[model samples]
Target: MSEHIIVRVAGVVEETAHVRTLRLEKLDGAPFTRFRSGAHIDVVGPTGVLRQYSLASSPLESSSITIAVKLEPEGRGGSAAMHEVKVGDHLKIGKPRNLLSIADDADQHLLVAGGIGVTPLLAMAYELYTWGADFELHYFTRSREEMAFAELLSERVEFRDRVHLHVGVPRDQQPEILEGIAGRLTSASHVYTCGPVGFMDQVRAVLAPTVGDDHVHIEHFEAAEIDTSGDSTFTVELDTGESYEVPADKSILAVLEENGIEVFKSCEEGVCGSCVSGLLEGTAEHRDNCLTESDRADQIALCVSRAASDRLVIELY
Candidate 1:
């Protein structure tokens, strides 16, 4: 029942320095389906790398889908390959999946985006604007030159003044800005954030005292790097009464896939919770940034997390 499909790259637009907007056209005969704001699609590439990029375009326009990718110098081949993609290139894409979605009952929305993390937030801004909903977008970057979609975002009526730009400042200088604007966020207003790990961490630290845990939503383009160097092997038990040994150097998801378990996953770095499953037993050494501490005790993300014990069991739904 997976909605995964292969699509052709229809076009590419240079959005800014080190950033390109990829336009994908569906090959299915049923035409393109709609995705809500804050939804992301996984693109499978060569070398078995599965990367997740948020859809930046509005869902109302279903003829095509767009994702903004920022080239990282130290990144693995994913971003580099995406940057070199040409028209007519075929890519495997998963259906739009959303973990950070806009709440319908929210009275107002506060969106904070950093660098390329602005991709999903931009879609949310569009959704709010189309509905004439109350919202504010705070975008932060190292410099104006690095910001994407400057022209389009600035031209929109709802985003022009409400969009606050923060650039060229030390880390200490950012706290005041975050506290000044985001201090009033309440249960009635949900705060959504996406960006580099440090950026998201700073935002979380600033708002942790003011906003409740349920009111904050975040998405990461890459998984958090964790030190998995250890000497151990764990047993992963599937729901079908099958078990496999996962080496310490590899992830549980990798072992399962090698054994033909066919689990749905994207963003193997653990940023996306697509590989999360119920933990039948054993303590998990949670290294992912996607789930909270409380959530880790009950469920585990097989992509990045490993077991703290010799034997761990998981039930895939």
Candidate 2:
């Protein structure tokens, strides 16, 4: 089930050429829920599109919640709709939920933010600063004009020294720059990165050679790419004894929703863990990046994962 609260856009600030910061407050004039540094909320826009955004506001501030958006013309129109919103316009947003956090035992934190992915890490940096924890933020943008919150962050006495800017130029020389940045991480440092798939993959590959896998944490700015040419039809057996034939072109989530089974999902590309269902029987050809070997009960992400067997049984109840 989806829970929503009504919020009014209190103000909007153009952080950069392409990014805008939306400051929101409860319509009731009451304090909003407290959220962790890396938490995100789902916004149901005026266009009837539901999209998730990482909170960029400090958790210590209860007056309002804020999110930064980068205008992506080719995206599903959520950002464009958000850009259209003006102060005083009301919006329905979900309560904050956290899927990322800092480790208490880490001696140092390395936050790497690429392009618009700086939203969550900005909040993390605030918390780290508040706690007086040792950390550094590497902010990457195509150019100085494209750096979100550059002035706001750079002017802050607390963030000025810790935030490093890495501007992009001559676009053809990214691989070398990315490699040098990724190679700086140390064993005692816990790394958190949010960026493009290729950016994260490059970081992981570089870290894998020396750093422990557990020390490197990442979140996807977009879904990872995968091939679907081999997809075939399959049967899904529900606990109620009813069955549904999922066509190769349709996802299990889509077939179930068409059959009146409401599944709560976000990031339909399967990067988010919202639609992961426990499996009672049958192996899943898991194609999602959210699941790991530690995931219990042979769970599967219905959005992308398909049946390894001809028929699969699921426990959705």
Candidate 3:
């Protein structure tokens, strides 16, 4: 069951110049349930502006959920409102929902985090630390001051030793440090990356040769906006032999929702993988930022992506 609970901010920890961690406690006698490592919660702000933030705290801790927010100077009032939230002020929040998660069969894990993308990766790292799994975090940022959880992460000697911070310029220019972690890249490793578009692109380019295609996992906070300039209408065939017409201006997801098809979605810009559907036939003109090329052949993100062919068949799971 889903409950829109009013949660009060217990405390705030300023992790960096632009980042602050908010600790929340449910006030309506709702039980604080444990979530997966990469889970996120949607916060309803003062003006009812909804925004999602990844949980930074470990899932093992069920007392409260911690989310780190980075104030964006040009953001659309979401970050600014989050910054203004006081200690005693109540905020509406949804239950935790996980889009990215650790695969149980993954032998070795390579985590790449950039800027505030470290939020989700940090929780995953804590889970790996608890399980004593083979994992390494390659954290990249412009400088140490811009990154959050540096002190908290560094305090843990065991996880700190596994984390290699790459500051200043990009990793491509720093060959020595990249070489040190190069040996860890293998087919047995599951490489998970999260960050901005440019940062994720660079990491994908650098490790494409070593990690292969299918083993690399990724999560994005924002997706690149695409130009939907094409023909007006396309046909979508469901597994039940139902067909629907989707307009070029509208996404497949919107068309489905209009028809009362309940598919999960977060980050409508196509960064989150919540709205992914299985492609049965026809080529998909993938405009999403989440899945790789190989993943696109079999899977399609209903949001921000369209059909390349005149007719497409998909199985909605």
Largest TM-score belongs to which candidate?
Answer: 1
Give one digit per residue, the lDDT tens place, for model 1 in 232-281: 78887876689899886888999998988888776777877888899888
Reference-based TM-score, model 1: 0.90
Sort by TM-score, best first.
1, 2, 3
Whole-model alpha-carbon lDDT for candidate 2:
0.81
* Per-residue accuracy of model 2 over 1-317 as CA lDDT, tens digit each: 27888899999999877789999999878997678898888888889788888899889899998998888899899889988899999988887876667777777888878888888898889899999999888777888888888887779865799988888733345556645755665677777778777776666666645456777777765777778899999999887788999999999999999999988788787766778888878878887866654563478889988987998888673
Structural similarity to truth (TM-score) of each candidate: 0.90, 0.89, 0.87
Predicted structure 2, TM vs. truth: 0.89
Off by over 4 Å in 1: 1-3, 27-30, 45-49
lDDT of 1: 0.83
RMSD (Cα, Å) for all candidates, in order, is 2.4, 2.6, 2.7
lDDT of 3 by residue, 1-317 (tens): 13578898988988888999998888864658878888778788776777788898888877778898889888788888888888888998887877678867777888888889988888898898888899999888889789799887788754678888888866567445554565766766677778887776676666656766666667777768677666468999898898999997888999999999888776677776678899999988898877777778899999878888998999987
N/CA/C clash count, model 3 = 0
The Cα error of candidate 2 at residue 303, in Å, is 1.5
